[model samples]
Target: MKVLVTGAAGFIGFYVSKVLLEKGHEVVGLDNVNDYYTADLKYDRLNELGISKKEAEIFKRKSVSSKYSSFAFIRMDLEDRTHLPSLFENESFDAVCNLAAQAGVRYSLENPEAYVDSNMVGFLNILECCRNHKIKHLVYASSSSVYGLNEKIPFSAEDNVDHPISLYAATKKSNELMAHTYSHLFQLPTTGLRFFTVYGPWGRPDMAMFLFTDAIVNNRPIKVFNYGNMERDFTYIDDITEGVVRVIEKPINDRLNEKEYYKLYNIGNNNSVKLSDFINEIENNLEKKAEKQMLPIQPGDVERTWADVNGLIRDYGYSPDTPIKEGVKNFIDWYRSYYKI
Candidate 1:
């Protein structure tokens, strides 16, 4: 199958692209390569997939990976009205995994426009292109943050997600709504995966695992938000990639109602580990104690997030099982090797 994976330079997108290539699928990856965190890290991820820094710097040009002939990349934004449609007309992708978006809950508070452009306008472009190109499946990245202010212990796909605490979450929720609209009106098979606290090697610098590991290794203080009272279902990258691959292979069909072609699932670990316990795993792996600075939860921050992935397991025959200790150890090892610490 020929697949188009947006945000291929991103953490999850990189892993997804690598796995797809390994399965002998031809993959065309697209990413804007914005400097929301660090462009060097994004480029490094591309390098791992055989896209050179020189090739990745040029926008809108397709560059094939030297390591995997089936994998190629293009540097472009999702919101580009002209080039996106042109690419769709040219490629005629069999399936599209749309993982590209401006992703930081707290950062959205400072830069609301960025969220609107990438997550809102950018997603619309993806839908339009998929609609026009007759793409078979459109699997997109949503967030557990969409279940904001809900007192539910384990967040389920069936539960109400009408209240999103952050602009990032709002945009993600909006993507789900937009996907349903296209799926209903145009008979597109769309699936939205509400990811939990995703973390592993090649992870984003802004994420908690990366931040805590970096601070601990450097002998700096690690900020404990919510005064050390928080929990998250930190899903591993490998598990996420595997689940996404399965979903891509199995697009929604006419076995259900015509309007029910749209589906949403919580792709998460299903085990919410406490914040202090998660920190302990990192400290244990690094053989160092963190200088902890307890802080109040910032605005747009949720107290806790736990995903109920039974629906995913039932549908996809898979569930995330990586333990927090193992995941943190893998991250710490990668961090030390990457930073020469």
Candidate 2:
């Protein structure tokens, strides 16, 4: 199958593209390569996928990966409706994994319009493209943050996610709603994966794991949010890639009803780890104790997040089993190697 992976420069998307290429699928990677965090890291991710920083720097031009002949990449944004449709028509993608978006919950508080443009309008373009071109499957990334203020221990797809604490979560929830509409109206097979706190090697720098590790390595104080009372279902990157690939392979193909065409699953470790325990594991890996700055929870932040991944387990016959200790060690090894710390 030929797959178009949006946000191919992203952490999850890069891993997913690598796996897909290894499985003998043709891949066309796409990303705007925005400096939301840093374009350098994004380019480095692309570099790992065999896309040269030089090739990826040229906007809207397709570059074939030297490392993997089956892989190709184009630097572009999702909301570029004119060019996006052209790419869809030209590539004739078998499936699309939409990981591209204005990520970071806290950043949304600062720039809410970015979320609306990328998550909402950009997603609409994807839905339209899939519906118009008759794509087989669409597996898009959702988030555990959508369960904001729900008080639900293990966030389930069946539970209500109407109250998203951050604009980022709201956009993700809105994507699910838009997907449902597309599936209902056009019978487009769409699968939404509500990802838990995804952290592993080559992870996002803005996330807790990276921030804490960076701070500790630099001998700076790490902020212990909510006074060390937070918990997260930190799913490793490889596990997430596995689940996403399975969903991509087995899209909601049955045409029983509109609901049948649209599916949602929580891809997570299914085990919540306390914030302090997580920090301790990182400290263990780095062999350095972090200076802690105790602070209250920031706005647009949840106290805890636990994903109920029974649906993922039942359908995909897989679960995220990587222990926190193992995941942290792997990340630290990669972090130290990448940064030469």
RMSD in angstroms, all models? 1.0, 1.3
Root mean square deviation (Cα) for candidate 2: 1.3
The superposed Cα distance between candidate 1 and the true structure at residue 120, in angstroms, equals 0.6
**Cα RMSD, model 1:** 1.0
Tens digits of per-residue lDDT for model 1 on 40-117? 999999999999999999999999999999998999988899999999999879999999999999999999999999
- Please report how far candidate 1 places residue 200 from its true position, in Å: 0.4
Per-model TM against the reference = 0.98, 0.98
Q: Give me the candidate number with maximum lDDT.
A: 1
**Tens digits of lDDT, candidate 2, 29-127:** 999998898889989998998999999999889999999999999988899989999999999998999999999999999999999999999999999
At residue 246, candidate 2 shows an lDDT of 85
lDDT values, one for every candidate: 0.92, 0.92
Candidate 1 Cα misplacement greater than 4 A, ranges: 254-259
* Backbone clashes, each candidate: 0, 0
